[model samples]
Target: MTSVLPRTKVSDVLFSCCQLLDISVKWTIQYDSPPKYPHYDPGTSRQLLCDQCPPGSYVKQHCTATSPTQCAPCPDQYYAEEWNSNDECQYCSAVCKELQYVKQECTSTQNRVCECVEGRYLELEFCLKHTECPPGFGVAQPGTPESDAVCKKCPEGFFSNETSSKAACLKHTNCSALGFKIALKGNAVRDNVCQENTDTTPQKCGIDVTLCEEALFRFAVPTQLTPNWLNILADSLPGTKVSTENIERIKQRHSSQEQTFQLLKLWKQQNKEQDMVKKIIQDIDLCENSVLKHIGHPNLTFEHLNTLMASLPGKKVGKEDIERTMKLCQPTEQVLKLLNLWRIKNGDQDTIKGLMYGLKHLKTYHFPKRTIQSLKKVIKFLHRFTMYRLYQKLFLEMIGNQVKSVKVRCV
Candidate 1:
């Protein structure tokens, strides 16, 4: 072995040294080289690398052998955020939708950014209102731009009386702590009601509270009557007059129906039930004359005629008469035809009184006995009240204790 190395082994060792030297040179070159930029060859049709434009700018002209690439800054409403070989800057086209506002303004290097306006949150690329906790629940975490409001049920000893997006559950009043007896226990939806320790007598009930509330609800005063009529009603109440401010506040705080309901509730609290009923009756009487004057007919309008025709006994009116009445196109004309037929059938009984009697006889009639009595009273008092008064009077009487039994028989 010491005498001489084999020629093949020496040759192999030389080849290995040459390969390592080549790899080392290549690695050194690659490590020392500058970073490659995005490039385009333009019309050269050759594999050539060219300098790229930096962020906020775009290439105006590709680099040639003798010159560097020409670049230009992006104009207003344009952006170019990355090193690029693009011919032109991209448009800043993002637009804020309804209930949204720009959180970050567009710039030469960046696109516009948007966020939801106050009281809303982002959801699936759309702005939506934050959830409001309903009565008996409270907000646990307020909403943010990216998240909806978090709500939780009010725990024991806590209450939340109103719907809210931000309000937390409130601790119920401790009547014992206040040196008073608890008149009513607290629940999630309402606070504990407290009274003096000395006051032990039970509270007096007023006008079958449940029945009265049901009657008030059925009245539908807001839908049926006008603001002027509401004012008149407010003035007619027996105790302290409802101020214009109070009415406005109620109207602002509640829907039309709720406004009327709240006002009725307040009035009920203020006056004796019997007095309220009596006053309502008197008001109705005053309005009846007005109703009659406005209608210009003591008997009924076309609507009333329609009801009468529908309720008439088939034996008395006959199918032919009913068919003829239905065939008439105009409501007034149909009513006149029915009246003529009715008059022909009965000589002296064709008047309003007779019509009332006939309507009463029909077992399937819609009008209640109270309505009949009110209509009869209207007939008796033809000499009194204005048309407006009569109309209101009739409506009030209809909505009284017998409201549940009442129906709009004549529109």
Candidate 2:
């Protein structure tokens, strides 16, 4: 009887049950498919937003639909210091000071730092005073915020009087030039103290008057005295007439002796005697021209003298050299006066000969700066004088030309 049910009825019944199960699952529990489009927002306009702001900058405003993040620079004397989302810059920790200048200027990333200027120094918390270079010392290096004033001892023959930075040690005074003697010799710290001469009479004559008189007198007389006449003049007579005759004869003999002496002097001068050489030299001028001739560069300038001096053992000469040269040249009337005096005092014949030889050579001699300056002044004066003469000549020539032109036109 179980097997007897119709085949059609069994198949239909199985199919209808399966369809009902599928419908129930679909209605009770749903399954979703993939989305149709990507997700987006109106504020960002599909663009990616930025991260936090970096240091030295601040966020001014948030992003909108059409714009990215907006930022602002930190103000002066303020800083952001780090990457921050802050709306405003932070104030600087270090304040500006009236006594100091800016060591490091303020920036968005760095703070301000201050320090002292020149002529000032820094104390513990602030800038204090500056130290000065004292007397007898000079400034080696200027003061700064990091270092105190540097000073050095004065050099030899130099001195400084007061505290200073700009001044150097000055050369000591030359007492000999002003007719004064050095009371105390100069040192590094002190100047040469001087004292005046109390005596009024001239210590020495500018020229040897005896040499000049002898040279002149020798040329004036003419005759020689006989030996017999000299004997008669030496002996005394007994009678008045004989005494008178003897007196007359002695006078005549003396006159003849004077004449002979004068003739002998002339002959010695002609022969160029050693004793008369100084007098002969005196007759010559010893100015710049003669000096140049002696140095063997009569056409050259003062520069030649400098070149010659440099050839000596010591290149640069001192004040003593200048003084010596001045003594030799200043007494225009007496050419060998200084040389003769020097020979008498030192009696160094070899040295005198060497000096004379050097003077005759073509060489330059170094002089003191003061002496050089004086020479430059003289040169300048000469230049001005030459220019004046040239101008006068040119003006006269122009006048002559004009006169000639006018005369020709009239003719």
Candidate 3:
């Protein structure tokens, strides 16, 4: 349908023809070539109408262009940008609609697939996975992160320890320490931690608490016992007491009878007062651990003397058990000898009162958790009589040089 015209050029034949001269004229014809194919514009896309879609994109429209390779994709996600000749648009970021979770990110042209939020699984036909099943009751395991785990009842004595745990609590341990039993256990009872024993009693006397507490309540008063030094231990002696009234009086006497009345009275008071009991325990923890240096007195510690006085009343400690444990402290002989000399010549008072206050360092840990049924007997006796310094002398002689030697350590 397109064409170019031919052009001709004329020579000087005009004069010859007019005069009847025989000069010939020459005619030349010129033909034009069709227009050249258009060169690609510098800014034009380098795409071909028949080209296949590039990676990350699919063909949306077939090419009207010379080459078909030029194709665009829908943007990723939701906020995708528009493109030319795009088949599936580029992806854009979209706030996931109602039921879908963000599964993938959107590109400049297309939107991503959104997954169903948890509790609902995806369906393969509509989505990728299946819908979540309903939470089953007694027949099922407890719920878990990965859908539902099997549910179960808490074992006896055991309750749930964690909200997320899927297992039922384990069964509680069968036996407990004497005088106590497990009331309720923490978490799954299946584990050993199902429940701790409540009671901590022995066949006779409270477990050598005067000796044992050192290991138990070591945190607050390290290397030291609870306050009341030795007296705090009276809690384990069942009926031991150290009433304010009788405490001083008993500090004056060493007899068995006097020791009973006062301790009984102190026990009557402290036993009924839960707060007082806790506070007393706390106070024992507050005592100072002054270095064992006697300013004008002896360098030896009289801890055994206090131990001996509390050991009396016979309500709790037998002579053998009391003696053996006290004798185990370090610098045994040196401490006893120093205590003996100090007791004899100090202010002419021959009582364990000063000695009791001096050894107050190791007092708090004397009692176990639940040994005291009624501490009035020992405590009442302790209040009624004063400890004569001679008791220290007597104790030193009784244990005498037989005391074992131990190394010096903080606790």
Q: Pick the candidate with the highest TM-score.
A: 1
lDDT of 3 by residue, 1-411 (tens): 986444322223343233211100110112132112222333355433243333334444455434433333223242323223335544454475666667776643345656665544434423222222222212135342234344455544544333332333433333232112444433442222212222322212111122112211221121332234224323333323443433433444433322332343244333534554444334322321111121112222344344433532323333454345345434423333333333333322222344444334334535321212112222222233232222223223322242212111111
- Candidate 3 lDDT score at position 246: 36
What lDDT tens digits, residue by residue, belong to model 1 across residues 300-390? 4444555665565432556566565555424323433454465435432323444456656544655444435544554444433353344
- Sort order, lDDT high to low: 1, 2, 3
lDDT of each: 0.57, 0.44, 0.33
Per-model TM-score, in order, reads 0.35, 0.28, 0.26
Q: By descending TM-score, how would the candidates be arranged?
A: 1, 2, 3
Minimal lDDT window, size 10, model 2 = 402-411
Candidate 2: C-alpha lDDT? 0.44
Q: Comparing 1 and 3 by TM-score, which wins?
A: 1
Please provide, for model 2 over 238-338, each residue's C-alpha lDDT reduced to its tens digit, 9 standing for 90 to 100: 11122233233234333453433322322333333344334333432223333322322223233434343332231244335434544444333122333
